[model samples]
Target: MLLKGKTVMVTGGSSGIGQAIAIGAAREGADVAFSYWGSDEGALKTKEAILETGQKALAISGDVALPESAISFVQETVEVLGKVDVFVSNAGICPFHSFLDMPAEIFERTMRVNLHGAYYMVQAAANQMVAQKTGGSIIAISSISALVGGEYQTHYTPTKAGLLSLMQSTAIALGKHNIRCNAILPGTIETEINRDDLADASKRSYMEARTPLGRLGKPEDLVGPAVFLASDMSQYVTGASLLVDGGMFVNLQ
Candidate 1:
């Protein structure tokens, strides 16, 4: 039980990586709270799973792109779970679009949800941790897209890169307060968000072949790394980007 009696709040926990992390934290003995923009069924399932682990769970409705929603989400988590020891800024969107003729709305929406949303959520969570005067952990669900270029993700890549940058800067800013901020760069986890992109059998097989691990990632694969960051295991680690891509990023010649 790495986080016994502690509280964790994650954004976009209705499904995918976010939902997995939320449940993983609960299993480690932390009270889990997640803010979701959609999927009532997913939210209920997350809550139930957490409770089954004998930990408290809270499901909040929020759009991380909005500053107030971020604030409210953090506030409610504290109101219910007392204090936040770990905060996961995982709410994001990536609408794949070509760079040659990207729609302004898609680009704007992607940035707002991925980058701006992280900014607000991290700020709100950091403020709460600072006020608590207790050191905490902040994890951003960045992507391998941050470290590499994506032809169809010109708009999406920048937002992920922005999240990685945000973690680095925030780490420096919040280090004095003992708040550790880090980013996790997953290569290509099989999630609904990118199901369409990988639907092409050729694309899927190519991606699998490109990775040194010879397989795609799963949402559950991130649990261990996230737990390490959230617990005392990473007490002295901060401002770092942990690549959980199963060797995909390093396979390029």
Candidate 2:
């Protein structure tokens, strides 16, 4: 129960990694509230999972790409879950497209959702923590793409790298208020977003073989790291990037 008595808020939590972290916090005895962008069924399932853990659950439907939406999501969470002890920025989209043939609209939307959305959400969450007068943790769901490259992620990688940079800068700005900021770099997690990409047998095997650990990651594999970042266990850790890639990043050969 590392998060006992704490209230955790998450964005893009209707499914995938975000949903896993939200429920993970609940399992650790924290009240969990999350923002989802119109995934009613997914949101309901996430809420049910959190409730089963005997912790409070709040499902907020809003677009993180809008600044006011992010602000209102925070306000609503505080009003319901009490106060935010930890905030996770996990809302993002990665629309795979060849660099040479990338559509301007697709690239722009990616920037708006992944990069701009995170900026707004993080700012809103930090402001609330400042008002609370208590130290808090902020975690961003950055990816290994921040360190490497992807052929179809030309428009996506930059945003993740931006997230890594965001944590570093915010760590300095928010440290005075005792607010800690960090990013998680996960590698090849099998989620809905990449299901089609990994569906090819050879592609999936190549990806798995690239990892020294011999497998791709599951959404739940990230829970422990997210919990660590959100809990006091990482009290002294800030402005850091935790790479949870199953040794893939090191298997350059």
Candidate 3:
């Protein structure tokens, strides 16, 4: 029970890595609150799973891309679960498109959701934590793409990179307030969003061959890192980027 009596707020917790983090936090004895953009069914399933752990859970629907929605999401979570001791900004979108083929609208949308949304959530959560005089943790779900350029992710990669910069700046700016901010960079994780991309034999083989682990990662692989960052174990860790990439990023080739 590393997080006993704490409250955690996870964005996009309806499924994938977000879902895993929310459930994992609940298992560690933290009350959980999460947001889903469009999947009511998935949200319900996440809530049910959290409740099964005998921890309180709240799931709301909202688009994090919008500032108002992001702010409201945090406010609602605090209203329901008390105060947020941990805020995981995990809602993001990745659309593969060559730079030449990327449309302006698509690029803007990607930035709005991945970068702008994270900014809004972090600000809201940090404000609450500062007001309460309780130090908190803010975790952003960045990507390995932030470090390595992707041919098909020109637009998406920038958003992830921007998140890294944002976390760094936030860490420095909020350290005095006792709020820790960090980014988690996951490699090729198996999730609904990237399932089709990883299903191709060639793509799967390419990823596996590049990763020293010889396998793609699962959402569950990130649960431990998320819990660690959210708990007291990472009190001294801030302004850092933790890579959960299964050694993929180390392959120089």
- Model 3 alpha-carbon miss at residue 207, Å: 0.5
Best by lDDT: 2
Location of the lowest summed lDDT over 10 successive residues in candidate 2: 62-71
lDDT computed for candidate 1: 0.93
| lDDT score, candidate 2 | 0.95
lDDT values for all models? 0.93, 0.95, 0.92
Ranking by TM-score: 2, 1, 3
lDDT per residue (tens digit) for residues 1-253 in model 3:
9999999999999999999999999999999999999999999999999999999999999888989987788788888888889999999988777898789999999999999988998999999999889899999999998998988889899899999999999999999999999999999999987888987999899999999998999999999999999999999999999999999998888
Model 3 lDDT, full chain set: 0.92
Full ranking by lDDT: 2, 1, 3
List the candidate 3 regions with Cα displacement exceeding 4 Å. Answer: none
Candidate 2's C-alpha runs over 4 A off are: none
Clashes of each: 0, 0, 0
Q: Per-candidate TM vs. native?
A: 0.98, 0.99, 0.98
- So what's the TM-score on candidate 2? 0.99
Error of 1 at 240 (Å): 0.6
Candidate 1: list runs displaced more than 4 Å: none
